[model samples]
Target: EPEVTQTPSHQVTQMGQEVILRCVPISNHLYFYWYRQILGQKVEFLVSFYNNEISEKSEIFDDQFSVERPDGSNFTLKIRSTKLEDSAMYFCASRSQTSSYEQYFGPGTRLTVT
Candidate 1:
């Protein structure tokens, strides 16, 4: 089965810098999402996308954050300005139209903001 893939397994950046995390979800999936886990915290939803538009977003997904499918295969999350609190393991997930409850997750990108 196909799986989600993410780039730059780990990233380190200074506070106030910009960072872009990339992913490639299962090609056949219709829904895409971005989630983050702050250290020992539970996973938190950031945003969801479908058909080239944002379907829903959490409060954490403020103006500083954005997501887009720049091409047929690549999905990206850009943080305009990083904050110390933004350090976490960021995951990219996707599920088919028929399975809304199950998501295939990528190997997360670990972001460290100092």
Candidate 2:
């Protein structure tokens, strides 16, 4: 079995600074996504990528945010300018092409902006 993995489990940044969260999804997965949980709030979908392009994105994924597959196996989310409100647990998820619809999630990268 394989799973998603993230780096810099915890990240602290200054407001207006840029930060990049990295994720390596299962090798065989086809769909990838980025989500965030703001402490006590529900998980919010940020963006999804497929076939080397963005498949969908939520309003929360604004101009400041971008996602890319920098390599064959690595998926990354970049926050151009960190904001205090961006503090949260950012999760990386991936799913296969099967009908199961089961998404494997990474432990998550906690981003704290001050």
Candidate 3:
């Protein structure tokens, strides 16, 4: 079965630097989303994209963040200016249909901003 994949697994970065987290969503899936969990916090939705435009985004998705489908299989999230609070496990997910809300998550790219 096809599965979502994330790069680096873990990263440590200085505050105010740029970081790009990479993901490869499940093949043939359409709806893509990014969520983050800050240590003991709940998984918070960041953004969801489909048909090449953002479908929905939470308040947490500020100007510092952007996402893209760089190619057929690769999806990317870029943080233009990282902050210490940005430390979290960023998960990439995808679903085949809108009616099916179950999201298959990647192992995650842990961003540690210090």
Say which candidate scores most in TM-score.
2
Runs off by more than 4 Å, candidate 2: none
Q: What does candidate 2's lDDT look like per residue over 17-69, in tens digits?
A: 99999999989999999999999999999999999999999999999999999
Which pairs in model 1 have colliding backbones?
none
For model 3, what is the alpha-carbon lDDT of residue 42? 99
Write the residue-wise lDDT of candidate 1 on 1-114 in tens digits: 789999989999999999999999999898999999999999999999999999999999999999999999999999999999999999999989987669999999999999
| Candidate that beats the other on lDDT, 2 or 3, i.e. the better one | 2
Model 3 alpha-carbon drift over 4 Å, by segment: 98-101
Once model 3 is optimally superposed onto the true structure by TM-score, how far is the C-alpha of residue 31 displaced, in angstroms? 0.7
TM-score ranking, best first: 2, 1, 3
lDDT of 3 at 91: 99
Q: What is the C-alpha RMSD of each candidate to the true structure, in Å?
A: 1.0, 0.8, 1.3
Residue 111 lDDT (model 3): 97
